[model samples]
Target: MKTAYVKVPFQFKFEDVPVPKCGSNEALIKVMACGVCGSDMNAARVEAQDWQSFGHEITGVVMETGENVSNVKVGDSVLVESGSYCGTCAQCRNGRPDLCASGTGLFQWKICGFSEYMTLDKQCLIPFDPEKIGYAQGTVIEPMGVALDLFYTTDIKFQDDVAVVGLGPIGLMALRLAKAAGARNVYGVVRNRKNTARIKLAKEFGATDIIYTDETPLEAYPFPAGGVDKIMVTAPPSVIASTFRAANLGAVIAYIGIDYGDRGTISFDANYFHYKKLQLRASYAVPALYFPRCMELIADGVIDVDKLVTSTFPLEDLEKAMCTLRDDKEKEIKMVMVRPELL
Candidate 1:
């Protein structure tokens, strides 16, 4: 079997290794298609002495399953969870599996989706009908689950004004979901006009307005009703304070992002937040709920996976794909790596 790994300064390498053995409660999945994430890009840039395994948004077919595994079987098409909760944990027993602390590591697999074959606990597999969804479309479910989590954190009402900071895949999807949820004016905020493709897609995906921070800061956007009813930030933490400036009074702001060092620390007006009665919420989708509903949304054409997945490459071409995604921000959206034969 062959798997992909990355090193600091954005380098990629491949190695051939023995196929992993499936445990009694595990299933072996033949890789089909895997979505490259912003986090994966972050991982590639992190300082590390050895190559680090990456790629989690995956969709594949079950080639083998252990005798004890009943949740999935051979020939089942599924979306693999990047991590899962321990069923016996207190939180899991109480029905809040997302809060379980003991199962935070990547399940039994050594390397994830960027491979020829991978095996994982049966509990992490969510079967989908292959006839209805293509391998590439199947990979979008996990990220949509992520976007859905951010949406759930906000109280967006019909005709409400909503703004999403950062136009990454998750951010773009969040804005689209806002439009489908009935937000009268959906705002897509970007740092500059260099992201022409994404800005155009934002409007196509139902953004009623676009805010470029380079020209006009978010806090001074002249939004109707003084500002938007709800705001979702998918950018780094550094941008959260500015995003808060664009929120309407009594509005709720939900965000999901990560940063290290100075960029992670954020500062905002305490008096402003208090006087405005605004709420700030953090959305971290783990044990990753909402796959079924999100899949339905994609299947029903409410969220078009095809439009978001702008490019696909063979696993061998991952370096080329990553370079395009990083340097060619204007033309790239979501990039996927696939095993042609499996697909």
Candidate 2:
């Protein structure tokens, strides 16, 4: 089997590797498409040591199932949740599987994805209709699930004004979800480079206004103080305080940025937060708990998955794809790589 590895920082190489085997209770999944996650770019730029195994946003077909597997079968078009939850955990017992411990996997053992083929427990497999979303687009459910989790972290009441700082895929999807959930006015914030162009698409998704933080000062965001009812900071830690600066009186701010390196902190006006009754919360990937609704949004045509994708490459272009994502911030937003044999 041919597999891709990060030869070093800023590089990826494909080489022949043995195919992974399945356990008695697991199933083998042939990769169809694996979307390049934003975190991949993080590991690429920061030189994270354990980034060789990429592709958490994966969608594949079941090639074989173990004797004990009953929920999934061969020929099923599926996505793996990767055993994100431990049912015994306090969060899990309270029905918050997304907050599950990281040690457990789908089959109650360790699971490693992002190869030509891999094994997972049937419990981790989620079957989806290819006709509705197709193989490549279905891979988006992984990031979408995380975006959905952010929604759960905050109360985005129907018709409330909302803002999403950093108009990346997650922010873009959150914009769309806010609209679908009936946000009266959706605001998008982005840097003033070529990234500001993303605001045009954000408007298409649901944003009513675009705050060019690069051109406009953060303290001057939304103008005259009292701004959006709710804000989600999808960018970095530095953007957290900016959200508060642009926040309205009694607003809720949800953030989801993990700075693996560097100081991930920012300074903001404490008086503003106190006087405005501002709220803040940090959000992270929650064990793929929202896969079903994520798929349903794509399948039901509620989410524009096609528009979200910027590029698609074959296995041979793995290096180019990673480099493009790392360097090409202006044009590329989301990309997926399809390994034909893995399908």
Candidate 3:
């Protein structure tokens, strides 16, 4: 078997490794496809974390399972949960498994998705009908769940003018979900003009407008009265105040972007922040509570996974794919890395 690790300074390396043994309650999975997330990009830059063998959004087939594993059988098609949590914890008991402290080292030692062969507990694998949704679409369930979590946490309604600030993969998925949830005018905001690839798809995903903030000023946002009803910020924290800048009266801003930096401070006028009655909320979704619903949506054709993914890479080309993301982020949207033998 071969395992991959994303080293610092944005590099990818692979080495020969033994296939992990399946435990009594675990499943041995054959890698199918793994979605390259924005978080993966963020993880590639840090010095403190291990980028080697760190991918969570994965879909694969169960090659074998331990004798006692009954949740999934051999040949089951499934999407994997990234973290292991103590089910008895207070957060777990309260249905907030994302907050579980037990799984604090998510990307450190977990080698499942980025490797050619992987192992995970049976409970971490969610089975779906592969005939209905293929492996590529299957990989999206996890990330889509993150977007769905943000949508579920907030209050959105029909005809609400929604603005999504940041056109990354999750932001694009948010655009699709906002449209599906009945937002009348969906706006996609980007910081670069070279992000034209994502902007075009944002329109297809039901973005009524695409705001390239670099070319167009924030003051020129085309909302009738003021700004948008709800703003979903998926970019850096520095841009949060700008979302407030283009916000409507009593708008809710759900922020989910993460950046490593001394660049966290955001400035906005105190009077406008008060007069408009703006609400800013952090949208951190995990433990994949909405995984099933998201999978069903993709399976039933409600959400088109076909449009969201712009490229696919063989596992051998993992470095090239990650570099494409690092060097050409503006032109790229979503990607799937696959092990050819699995399919």
The segments of candidate 1 whose C-alpha lies over 4 angstroms from its true place after superposition are 47-49, 104-108
lDDT of 3 at 223: 78
The deviation in Å at residue 313 for candidate 1 is 0.5
| TM-score ranking of the models | 1, 3, 2
Model 2 TM-score is 0.91
Off by over 4 Å in 2: 102-113, 222-225, 269-271, 341-343
- Write the residue-wise lDDT of candidate 2 on 6-65 in tens digits: 534666666677776888877888888888877777767665465365556777889988
The global Cα lDDT (0 to 1) of model 2 is 0.75
Q: Residue by residue across 167-211, what tens digits does model 3's lDDT show?
A: 877888888889998998888998867878788888888888888
- The worst-scoring run of ten residues by lDDT in candidate 1 lies at 100-109
Q: Model 3 lDDT vs. the true structure?
A: 0.79
Better of 1 and 2 by TM-score: 1
As for TM-score, the candidate ahead, 2 or 3, is: 3
What's the C-alpha lDDT at position 229 in model 3? 88
User: Each prediction's TM-score against the native?
Assistant: 0.96, 0.91, 0.92
